[model samples]
Target: MTVGEVMSKDPVSIREDDYMTHARQVIRDNFLRVLPVVDEGNRVLGVLSDQDVLNIRSSKSNVTVRGYIRETPLITPDMDLLRAARELLDAKQHHAPVVSSSLDRSIVGILSDVDLLRHIQPTKRSPASVEEIMTAKVETAYPDDSISRIWDNMLHWDYTGIPVVSHKKEPMGIVTRIDIIKAGYARIGTANMHGRSSGGSMRVEKVMSTPLYSVAPESSISEAIGEILRNDIGRISVTDGGRLVGIADRHDLLRACLEGTGL
Candidate 1:
């Protein structure tokens, strides 16, 4: 299969000159992981991810997309699906703009890890367990922790999601970047930047995704993938006897698939 077969065509994009506030709204409204940054002629520039938008302090900020635009591999629609996944992984980005050709940078579509996941199958090689690829040293947030504190932790550690745990370390829920963004609390750590006192008062439990989905350490990679796709979540908790042991995300599963298939 090819990238064009799975990629989202005519993706929502922002002009390089657009303000970060607009970019934040576009991403929040569309639930986009990344927004393609384009020129006036619709040529691809780069992309602004949800993480980038977290840097915005107020809804009235005048920062342009150009400064925050992150360079990503430009994918062509004709590229092999697996190969495109590999390139995106290597670039450490979940989304990439798809152009017609190398010489023509005009974006015709957009590709994402989720797009690739829909077409991926369990590797033909020996199946691996989720434990083999999960990130064990997870940073978690307590339910009582202030959103401001959690937000600071997420930015300081570059974490997409942090599991909210109980005093005993049992997973209760997960707070993610989108969760904060969707709740209109993307400000990295400026609780008083715009006098948004409520932003600092909010608790992790209020913004966290509940009924946390999880997989056992011994579960197959395919099982973990199924849980993620089924729940439409970025990652799942890896638990053993109801205790959080690790976390497995799309990148981990994608890597395992590529390595196992030797793609």
Candidate 2:
């Protein structure tokens, strides 16, 4: 498979001069975690992500995309899908901008984790089981865990989502970065009026998403990929006899694809 065959075409881009608010709006509106930044001629300059926004203490209305731009590894349409996936992982990004394979480097598309996983879902290429890529440490939270501490761990470990497990170590719900920002962002000052602080008093079940989406550890990578693509989720919890075993996210998929572990 090649990048051109699976990449999302005509990707939505943020202009270099666009306000940071616009960037945030674009990300939220498109349900995107990352977006490419482009020049006036539609050439990629950098990328913007929700994580970048989350890191900002505060952004002024005039703060342009340039302030938060992050350079990404560029890809070409003719590049091997696995090779492109490798580049993305090495660059610590879930997506990359694809150029025309010409001297001008004009942006033509965007290749993302979801795109690659979508392609892998149909192929028998990934023969590996979920155990190969799943994280064994499996950081988790309880229903009563303080949101402040949970948020700290999430940012510290770069965990996009953490499974909320019961005392018996069974999966209950999941709290994601989006869930925190959504529930806490606008409720900051209102905490005092409500007689409770935002994150400090918020419970896991209060903001966590319920009805977990998951895959068994013995399942094929393709099965896991299918779960991710079909559900439009960032990662799949790896379970064993209904217990949380681990998690397989885009980074795992990139490693699998890079090594050609499944074919």
Q: What is the C-alpha lDDT of each candidate?
A: 0.83, 0.76
Candidate 2, pairs of clashing residues: 125-262, 125-263, 127-262
- Candidate 2 C-alpha lDDT tens digits along 1-263: 99999998888888999888777767756656778998999888878876665444343557788978897887999988767776787888887889988476789999988777666433345546989778888889998886666766776687788999988888998988778667753222334212345535667787899878988888887788778778777888988898888898877864665453432
**lDDT leader:** 1
Residue 65 lDDT, candidate 2, scale 0-100: 84
| TM-score, every prediction | 0.90, 0.81
Alpha-carbon deviation at 239 in model 2, angstroms: 2.1
After superposing candidate 1 on the true structure, give the runs of residues whose Cα lies further than 4 Å from its correct spot: 187-200
- Output the number of the TM-score-best candidate: 1
Per-candidate alpha-carbon RMSD to the true structure: 2.5, 3.6
TM-score of 2: 0.81
lDDT of 1 by residue, 1-263 (tens): 99989998879999999899898778878877779999998999888977778656675877888899888896998999889989999998888889989899998998989888888776766357988889999888999787777777776676788999999988899998778777876654454322344545777787898977999999998898889999999888999988999998888888877866666
